[model samples]
Target: MIGRLNHVAIAVPDLDAACAQYRGALGAVVGAPQDEPDHGVTVVFVELPNTKIEFLYPLGDNSPITGFLEKNPAGGIHHICYEVDDIMAARDRLQAEGARVLGSGEPKIGAHGKLVLFLHPKDFNGCLIELEEA
Candidate 1:
């Protein structure tokens, strides 16, 4: 159902400092900040040879990242996204297997401009999982 690991998302309180750490200290190729209003996050993608690292910051008052940051003030890994060949098929399979899908059980446009869906963290060993159309 899931393909390659898409990216690991990290929720951060300070977006600027996070980007600077990756860019200056790690010497990584960090991309520009992109506002995902629907998802309510401002994301910065750090490109790497194997996979990408997504830095997520709150975009609005009700942004999910806001709550995440509140729980983890220092920020931490928010979710791990995996690619799927067919998102609907993957969703169906997971649902049949008693997995809970987050939100409306519908795919949303992700930061990569692709259809994405989030699964309940509890079902996945307490680690939030995101599935993106490959």
Candidate 2:
């Protein structure tokens, strides 16, 4: 079902500081901030040799990241996204195995412009999981 680990998302209260840390201090190649209205987040991708690290910040008052930041003031790992050859098939198989899919059980355009779906954190050991089409 799941393929390679796509990216690990981290929620941060200060997007600029986070990006500066990665770009200036760590000397990482940081991508520009992209607003994902559907996901209610402004993301910056830090490129790496193998995978990417996504920094997520609230885009609006109702943004999900806002709530996450409220609970975790210092911010933390929000989710781990994994690639899937076929998103629908992966969703079906996961559902059949008694896993709960978040939202409408339909794929949404992700930051990479690929179909993505989120799974319940409770089912995945308190870590939110995102499935993105490969």
Candidate 3:
């Protein structure tokens, strides 16, 4: 089952500018920037009160994040990631409840060395859901 709200991921065009904006506006500091070659994204994490905010930008045109930004030009919230105790169990429960998963099987390595998996937006009422084990 879901444990806590881990982080909210926001898609941005520029990572540095977005990090600066968050730092100036909310006093958030960039924890670390990670490059995920498989996902084709470079992510910067800004630590918040109990959770964190993730800024994502595509590494190239073929990136999935690029297509996402193209569809949502404003580059808004991409997904809400929730911390989970057992990823496989949580995924199974979700599937049993009629939620569709984006990937075929198993959680994969995500930003900050966390195991992550995504639930299809259609199954979550148009909100992209991410399950992460920390």
The CA root-mean-square deviation of candidate 3, after full C-alpha superposition on the true structure, stands at 1.5
| Stretches > 4 Å off in candidate 1 | none
Candidate with better lDDT, 1 vs 2: 1
TM-score of model 3 (CA atoms): 0.91
Residue lDDT tens for model 1, 51-102? 9999999997789898888899999999999999999999999999999999
lDDT of 3 by residue, 76-117 (tens): 899999899988888889888888888775889877578889
Q: Tell me the lDDT of model 3 at 50.
A: 90
Question: Sorted on TM-score, highest at the top, how do the candidates line up?
Answer: 1, 2, 3
Best by TM-score: 1
Candidate 2 structure quality by residue, lDDT tens digits, 48-122: 999999999999768988888989999999999999999999999999999999999999888789999999999
Residue 130 alpha-carbon offset, candidate 3, angstroms: 0.7
CA displacement after TM-score superposition, residue 3 of candidate 3 (Å): 0.7
lDDT sort, best first: 1, 2, 3
What TM-score does each of the candidates earn?
0.96, 0.95, 0.91
